[model samples]
Target: MKVAVLASGRGSNLQAMIAEWQEGTLPVEFVGVGSNNLDAMALTIAEKAGIPVRAFPRDNYNDKSEQETDILNWLEDIGTELLILAGYMLVLSPRFVRTAEYPIVNIHPALLPSFPGLHAQKQALDYGVKVSGCTVHYVDEGMDSGPIILQETVPVFDEDDEETLSARILKKEHIIYPEAIRLLANGKVKRDGRRVIIQRDS
Candidate 1:
């Protein structure tokens, strides 16, 4: 499977995926990496790995439509079969979501349906939840509201701050994100409404 990654900031999850691919654990070719920030570290990681990288700066475009058009064009050119948002900050346009021929997946820091947007770790901390974790899910028009693919929980300590909680959650993110992709790559995923079913060989 040919995959493209979209990310912003430090791409620890992206790095994990790359490591899995390099180690022959995850079966997918990273065709390209795209970012909204030219200075994004994810772009640097991709360059270091000899993968194609592109930046679609929102400031350079007049509207989201134009920006998404360029991104779509690039994905088409690279023949991307799967799109992975690994810490990507931008919310995809609904049109782009509807138009994408391939499935899009994202790894969220919080067990979704509870904390969906920015500062998710803080949201969990503020809520005083005893447990917090990461969720890997398909991307729909709604924010982190797509069908759940995989999720693993981590205990929340009373002394935990946002940074500490995030780090722990990120460790789980690194584990399940690639596993989710592996399922997709192997044609073992199916969706029925909001539920994702992982098929095992019969």
Candidate 2:
């Protein structure tokens, strides 16, 4: 599979994927990395990996539609078969979600259906949840409301704060994000409405 990543912050997840790919554990080609922030470390990681990188800073476009259109066009040009969102902060407009030609997936720092948007870790902490974790799911028009592909749980301590919980969830994110891509790349994942089915190897 040919893949492209969109990230707005540090690309720890992207770096994990790249490491797995380099180790021959993930069978995909990273075609490009795109960011809305020009200074995103994700772009630097991509460059270091010799993958193509592009920036679609919101300031450069008059409207979200225009910016997304350019992003879609770039993805098309790169022949991207899979789109991965790794800390990409922008809430994609419904049009962009509907217009994208390939399936898009994202890693969220909390078990979804609980915390859907930004500050998910903080939300989890504030809610007094006993467990917090990570989720890898398909991207829909709604924020983090897509079908879940995989999830891993971590215990939330009584003294845990957003930072500490986030760090724990991030460790899980690094593990499952690449694994989710591997599942899709190997045709082991199937979608049944809002639910995702992972086929077990025979």
Clashing pairs in 2: none
Model 1 spans > 4 angstroms off: none
lDDT of 1 at 43: 95
lDDT at position 97, candidate 2: 85
Q: CA RMSD for every model? A: 1.1, 0.7
TM-score, cand. 2: 0.98
**After TM-score superposition, what is the CA distance of residue 99 in candidate 1 from its true location, in Å?**
1.0
For model 1, what is the C-alpha lDDT against the true structure?
Answer: 0.93
Query: Candidate 2: which stretches are off by over 4 Å?
Result: none
Model 2: per-residue Cα lDDT at residue 172: 92
Model 2, 1-202: lDDT tens per residue? 9999999999999999999999999999999999999999999999999999999999999998899999999999999999999999998889988988899999988888899898999998888999989999999998899999999999999988888888998999999999999999999999999879999899
